[model samples]
Target: MARALPLFGLVLLASGGLMGCGERTAARAALSPPDRAEYMGIETQLLDASTVSFIVRMRGARDRSDVVAYARCAAAQYTVIRGYSFAQHVRTNVRRSGEIWEGDGGFVISPDLPAGRRNLDAEVIVDDCREQGIPTV
Candidate 1:
């Protein structure tokens, strides 16, 4: 009876493993990893003395988060361009048309660090962006 039980368990396990092998392999092959983000370009607009708007476009983004990141990188670099050391994120609007993703981000540039959780030190962010292979304005 013990030998029969072991043989039955092995048969069940083997059948289970074989049953879905073809389908599982096909599904995995069909589901390829998303392509890496391709940054298209960036446009910077100064809204006010302390406020700015960044319009960023990219391709191959997996989601809106990539768009936001691209915009943030632009804002960080623009802050440095204006001789500012910090930037606060106000908001970002994201949209996609076909393969191109666009993000319009609002940021406040400051010589001093802003009092917000969404704020970033311009120099640090630029370095991080570069490390991540993301471009800056």
Candidate 2:
């Protein structure tokens, strides 16, 4: 009976460990290295002068984040090309069909860094994009 009790406790512990590690599993997944995303192309539209729209597409994304990153890279390069130092993200819509991912992002380009958590420094983001092997438009 003593040996049987220990075995039962071991079984309970093993089962509990499996069911209680959901958050740990999610954290591990979040920390996993990014997959290689293939840059397809970027289309730029002038919503106005300071406001610009970027349509970016790619493949091999792990999720919608890759598409959003592609759009961010495009927006950064576009801001720099327009002689702006910063861009504030307005909105981004991401969609995935099959293996392809598409992101439509709108930004307000400014000579100075905009006041927002979502504001992006054009030069810094462009550099990051380059380092990450992400193309910009």
Candidate 3:
């Protein structure tokens, strides 16, 4: 029984070490936002009276989808701030360099909701983003 006791202890230690070997925990942690200084930012430029371009930058975010969503949320809020009821997506480009992810999106705002285009209602989008815990502006 003495020898069996030592073998059991060794097995327990080995199992504990194995539990920490997987990358799942590391991947999950990587998705979380970094410190406040490295948080996401959006810069908007008006290309015309009804069209605007947005550049979104996020640090320590590897997923392009999240970066693009931030840009969309910005466009939605900008539309509302401009007194427009809706925004139509014109185009978007996404890229990643080092630890930062960037997305550029162009939108056209209209007082009358556009049809037959990829569009979103500013009020509805803002509310949806709020419910999803996504920051907008």
Clashing pairs in 1: none
TM-scores, one per candidate: 0.73, 0.74, 0.68
Ranking by lDDT: 1, 2, 3
lDDT winner among the candidates?
A: 1
RMSD of each: 16.7, 14.8, 16.7
lDDT of 2 by residue, 3-62 (tens): 221211222342454334675556334423267667889999998879989998888888
The list of candidate 1 runs beyond 4 A from truth reads 1-35
Could you give me the TM-score of model 2 versus the true structure?
0.74
As for lDDT, the candidate ahead, 1 or 3, is 1
Candidate 2 ranges with C-alpha deviation above 4 Å:
1-34
Candidate 3, residue 17: lDDT: 35
Clashes of each: 0, 0, 0
Query: Higher TM-score: candidate 1 or 2?
Result: 2
**Rank ordering of all candidates by TM-score, starting from the highest:** 2, 1, 3
Off by over 4 Å in 3: 1-38
